[model samples]
Target: MKYLIVGLGNIGAEYADTRHNIGFNVLDALAGASNIAFTTDRYGAVAELRHKGRTLVLLKPSTYMNLSGKAVRYWLDREKIERENLLVVVDDIALPFGTLRMRTRGSAGGHNGLKSICELLGTEDYARIRFGIGGDFARGQQVDYVLGQWTEEERRLLPDRLKVFGDAILSFACVGAERTMNLFNKK
Candidate 1:
């Protein structure tokens, strides 16, 4: 089976290590652990990983957060991967820090990246993994908070959290979204 694992984040050093870039961070960890490397590719950075007889095509969109759907659509078509086998990793401020949730389909919940994906894909039925970045900012500071670098404490805890995130991703591609959600949503 083939799966498209998209990690959404703005492409630039300014965006690196920010809370909004958790998707990229998770993909990086997964790739590193699997001894794979990403290469610059059309609309994104691309990497291939094999797990349990499944091929996972990892993507970190260069289209930036708001325009992520362009890259996603391009890769999905190029890869000829079914929408059912697609997974998007995104940051969520609704949940507490380090929390993770997997859903088969849902609204974008004010995320522009997800909104673009939903719009371009013409449906919200794809799977997504929302990684919590916490909602500790004051009102109207949402943008700054998301693009901000992690706190010292958060940095310390991130490696462990990312490992779990990577594991959940692998579970989704290997065992299917339903089973993976049941296994990781409680974490």
Candidate 2:
């Protein structure tokens, strides 16, 4: 089987290591865990991971954050991967930092990258792995909060958190969504 795992984040020096780029961080973790190298190319920086007889395509959209749809649609069409076989990893502020959530399908909930993807695909029924960035910002501070780099405390827990998220993502790709959710999806 084949899977398309797309990580949503902005491209550029400024967005690296920021809360909004946690998805990219997770994709980095996946590459490291698999001992695979992401090569620069057309769709995006991509690495093919083979696990337990399955092929997993990891992607970090090069179209930046808001225009991520183009990259996603292109990849999905080129790979002929079903919408259900695509997993989008994204950073979510509604949940606490280091928290991970896996859902079979759901709305973007105001995430620009996700919203763009939904518009391109014309559907929301795809798997998703959401890495919590924590939300406690004041009004009009949402942009700063997400685009900001991780706090000292969040950075402290970054390693273990990334491991957990990485493991959960692998499980999802190797096994099934129901099983992955059962093993993850907890406080």
Candidate 3:
């Protein structure tokens, strides 16, 4: 089976390691663990990993966060990967830091990247892994918080959290969304 694993984040260096870029960070860890490198592609950075007869296609969209669906749709069509086999990794502000949530389907919860994906795909039925960045900012500081770099404390705890995210992604591909959720979702 083939799975399209999309990490939603902006393309620029300015966005690197920001709270909203946890998706990219998680995928980077996964790729590093497998010793796979991503190459610049038409609309994103792409990497391929093969394990136990399954092919995992890792994508980091270059279209920025709000326009991520364009890259996602393009790759899905080009790769002919089924919608059911697609998994999106994104940051979430609703949950506390270090929390991970996997859902089979859901609304975007005001996340621009996820909103774009749902708009382009016309469905929210695909699987997604939400890495909680926490809503710790004061009122009207949402954007700054999301785009800002992580605090020193958060940076210290990030590696282990990312490992959990990587494991969840692999479990999703090796098993299935429901089973993977049961195995990895924070309770």
Most accurate candidate by TM-score: 1
The stretch of ten residues in a row with the least summed lDDT in candidate 1 is 8-17
Clashes of each: 0, 0, 0
lDDT of 3 by residue, 95-145 (tens): 999899999999999999999999999999999999999999999999999
The global Cα lDDT (0 to 1) of model 1 is 0.96
Residue 2, candidate 2: how far off, in angstroms? 0.6
RMSD of each: 0.5, 1.0, 0.8
Q: Score each candidate by Cα lDDT.
A: 0.96, 0.89, 0.94
Order of all candidates by lDDT, from best down to worst?
1, 3, 2
What range of 10 consecutive residues in model 3 has the weakest lDDT sum?
178-187
Give the per-residue lDDT digits (tens) of candidate 1, residues 1-187.
Answer: 9999999999889999899999999999999999999999999999999999999999999999999999999999999999999999999999999999999999999999999999999999999999999999999998999999999999999999999999999999888899999999999
- Per-prediction TM-score: 0.99, 0.96, 0.98
Cα TM-score of candidate 1: 0.99
Candidate 1 pairs with clashing backbones? none
Top of the candidates by lDDT: 1
Q: List ranges where model 1 is wrong by over 4 Å.
A: none
Q: Alpha carbon lDDT of residue 136, candidate 2?
A: 73
User: Per-residue alpha-carbon lDDT of model 2 for 1-187, expressed as tens digits?
Assistant: 8889998898899999899999899989879987999998785898999988888889999998888889999999988988878999999999988888999989999999999999999989889989989997899999999999888888999989988988887898788888999899883
Better of 1 and 3 by lDDT: 1
